[model samples]
Target: MTALPQMILTPLARYGWATHDAVDRDEGAVLRELGRIGEMLGARIAGRAGAIEETIRPQASDDAHPRSLSAQFGLNALPFHAELSHRPRPCRYLLLGCLNPGSSGAATMLLDWRTLDFTADELRLLESAPVLVRTGRRSFYSTLLSPDHAFLRYDPGCLEAVDARGRCALDLVRRRLGSGLSEVHHWRRGDILVIDNWRTLHGRAPSRPSSGRRLARMLIDA
Candidate 1:
């Protein structure tokens, strides 16, 4: 498989995110563009099996869950973290496009691991620390920062276990990577954002009571 062009890969590695405004807003055209990009990156665009592709919006039931938007801060919603971070072969990228920006407040935020300002000690701690993550009924262990590529597999939402040092390291990372280091993207119709899921953390802003936000999302893997 061919690798992504350096022109695209460079910014993705350095910033962890990129955006493009589409002149052709038709769903078919947008999808074709996405497929072209995915092919160049040697990735296949995927969605949840058995699910239909459509505009995504917040649900009232999402509020009932502690992890939902209603429970999170109005301005800064908790990030999705790494849903597939712990997997041996995790999703490599995420693509989200706005069909409607919505009258209700909703924006996407991204944090680049490369941009985090970590002290030498904190970095050392993160490199060596282990953490437990739980998804559904399954549990597994992984380091916050991988030794090989410094890849991060942190999901504050799914964190199940951590020791004192690990906890401290996580706290420091969260504190530093929060709103301060995040880049907020206010959606506009036809705006598409591509993210390096392995190297960045992403979240959404809280939606208003009657938000009209609609987005189409796809995961990509090589």
Candidate 2:
């Protein structure tokens, strides 16, 4: 169930992402399959995490797994953000393998920040903007788009404006995305998509319960 990670790595610079076919794949046993695949790609499995993979499917926010993305967002669309952005340091890469394509309405959405052309003034303001990001009982201040790293750390759900600049930056970012500039990653059964989590913002489009769409996700380190 694993793809050649090196093959995906080679073309990532230009494609922003890569894909490999699982070929004659079966959905019933892919959760453990993804875990094994994640281990092959060096998944950070030694932390507090209970497992190295997750199954994404439609459910109510009040479901048993309330904290899950499937529960929080349900069949609705999700906002653009990196995986694990709420953590102290997000995962470096992500892999998503399609199990069920559903009714075809559930597509993965992507927005590459490197392609955004921010004005010098806006960039300057963003570099200085400091927002308090809350993660449960923990919180930290970050500029979101820091110059020290190529990655972007952002999640609108938890950002609390710390100052005028932070507030402006937050509003500005929201407006920027409001422009509707993004790429759509359509999925097919047996297809695996690899993403550089640090370099791209990703989300999900709407789905219907009847579609039966499902995807397996895994996070790995560099």
Candidate 3:
């Protein structure tokens, strides 16, 4: 009998995705590995990379996904949304590494726009629209549009909308919640998953304490 080909999961045709086995216990090693991968992938996809480093810790890093937004100011959740960082320079690649893997309910969820339900216009808006994102008394301009990326911050204070280019992306995302695009996977120790910020969104489910801990290192290639 012939053996099957190794089932390697690539991010997508238009995007790049990858996962690496991890073994470092120190935060610095995790960050360094993440940066190395980001640099390599960013050079291939985005042609260049900005700065890559460990996200500064915030106050609400313990709550599930959105609730943790305050403390995880620059970190992203599983199965959540993404886009570019600055204007006209969408983030083309993203990399996340699992330093510690929690047991049970701490799975990361993912959603692909093509799998979500939306009208042609909604789709276009998500690809090229601007969003008004509020981080606090300080608000930064961003959108779901091309070349625009955002760190999924958990600041209820943080909100986003297209300045004037479009307004339906978020609306459609909310409306399409039940389309079954949701994907969930647990990251084991030494595991890494890289995603195309433009084509995928990720978030996480709640988790209870276990023998192992959960520390994820994340970065972007723009």
Candidate 4:
């Protein structure tokens, strides 16, 4: 198995993400390893956290998860975005444990928001831009960037720009992808990734079609 030589926790604080290889590919064991990491971080499983199975190739069209990145983009590379940005407080940490290594090049992609090279004007406009965030159960308004320049609220599918500046901010970000410190990690059975979802934007890269790619997902709060 491809395990990290040093402690996995080091990278989390440094790069906003880290990965560890488990002893087995079994879902139960992988999940246990993830839970252990959460404990070490003084975090707890999120209220809505649970397992998720990811397939690179569509199978029978998953209506249940019609809005999922895989369901919409298939095996193609997905755009970068923060998870559950529509929520009042987006998920803090995202854990993904691999149960199967489907194929090569279909790695998980990460980009730190701090690396975005935006001009002063662009940053100001985005920080003041109002956005309409809506989900089936609720709707609210918030800025694309926090006043303190901390959390970036972004989710292409749910966040709608409410003004011209908001629209411009969205467009500028779309063009700025792949310009920062981007990292891609190919999945291997027994590999588990811990992402500081709040500080990082993540998506998947293009890969060969395969339904064998499976990942169990969980959310954590510190």
Candidate 5:
């Protein structure tokens, strides 16, 4: 049997992401490679309901507060947050690739949790405070810091809607994860990015309206 390509696990652990460039353009080949890598990581491909979402600009709507297709489809913009925050089984890893690079604004931004610098008081506060996350009709509560591993499960926009304490915590986290440490990735054809969802927050920059950018996304669970 042919040997599978070895997975690169270091960058994702240390920096919260591992990027692979010039991936095979064939979709079937790419999926197979991703599946193999996912298996090596002891993670299964996430199911359809929460996996393989396509982020694209929407057609113009006449509503007073016109929302972009991304927002309409529940795809989040540049807010610092973990994916599937409201779910019992949040994705352990996220795989994102560019299918079509739009004419404007579809860059993805990532923040490494390891790089965030918080004061002792702020850390204590984050560890103690509970954040309420609500998506559509579903709702749940979680702390920013995991009691066991101190991993973060943050979604600032959700917190901003719920209460003052949560908002303050979000602000503190945002301040710590300033522009300096945040990494912005402009997608090219055949590029794939794997992120450790529990250790990183991912979002996108505002894309131009009707720009044809399309991204293929998948989630994995360990």
Candidate 6:
């Protein structure tokens, strides 16, 4: 892994056009510096700062290829999974900047592999040839109410892995997230949450959409 920068930018709480805007008319010099710093940190952690370029994508929508995708709720609840696990390509780093927040229940939940318990059989299953995971039509098990959106499928093949341990490590992650949970962090505007897409699995808790839009931009570190 490359070395990360000493400077760290915490997520902000308040919202403003010029300050947080990605394509602001009056962009701040700090934004430029932040991008540079992002490059450095992303390279160190993910191996390529530019790995998440436009040729690849993170969203399921085909119309507008946005590096950032806004997640909202419909009648059905959303399930938890990595950003993109089905296809061959996925971004290394996912940066989420929350624009608006809802009521108390909208928490951003995640299952960390660092501190999860794994059974021997589950470990064997995970270590066995990468488990074939399919999303959408490809999935062996069908999910309810086919989403218009594209969700990443995480199976054994997704890992560009060589050793069994690497495969096993990822498998352990899949085993733990049997069903989504309610534990999550509620986002505040200007709050930027950076997730190691490969290391962690994330999900959203059920909530009733309120007055404003919970708009957010997802950026690949590259």
List model 2 lDDT by residue over 1-222, tens digit each.
355567666766665677776745787554555555566666553222456566667665565253445555766787787777667777877888889888855788887776677788888787788888777677777777768657777666666788888999888877777674788888888778778788778888887666787788788886
Q: Between candidates 4 and 5, which one is better according to lDDT? A: 4
Could you tell which candidate, 3 or 4, scores higher by TM-score?
A: 4
- Candidates' C-alpha lDDT: 0.68, 0.72, 0.50, 0.72, 0.65, 0.41
For model 3, what is the error of residue 12's alpha carbon versus the real structure, in angstroms, after optimal superposition?
A: 4.8
Locate the minimum summed-lDDT window of 10 residues in model 5.
Answer: 63-72
Residue-level lDDT tens digits of model 5 in 37-68: 65665555544254444433323334211222
lDDT of 4: 0.72
Q: Can you write out model 3's per-residue Cα lDDT over 1-222, one digit (the tens) per residue?
A: 232113213434433344565458466677676666656554433321233343321123564234234345423332354533332444556566666664553677776655655566765566666566653444455555444323221112234564554445555665665465566767675666777666666656654434254554444544
lDDT of 1 by residue, 36-128 (tens): 666665545444332324346655544444543334443345464743564544578877778778896588878877677777777788878
RMSD of 2: 3.2
Cα shift from native, residue 101, model 2 (Å): 1.6
Clashing pairs in 4: none
Against the correct fold, how does model 1 do in TM-score? 0.80
Error of 3 at 40 (Å): 1.1
Per-candidate RMSD, Å: 3.4, 3.2, 7.3, 4.2, 4.2, 10.6
In candidate 2, which residue ranges exceed 4 Å CA deviation?
Answer: 1-7, 28-41, 45-49, 64-73
Q: Which stretches of candidate 3 lie over 4 Å from their true place?
A: 1-16, 23-32, 43-52, 55-79, 83-90, 124-130, 136-143, 147-157, 160-169, 209-212
Better of 1 and 3 by TM-score: 1
lDDT of model 4, residue 85: 80
Give the least accurate 10-residue stretch of model 1, judged by summed lDDT.
45-54
Indicate whether candidate 2 or candidate 3 has the larger TM-score: 2
Which portions of model 1 show Cα errors greater than 4 Å?
1-10, 45-55, 61-76, 86-89
The CA-based lDDT of model 6 is what?
A: 0.41
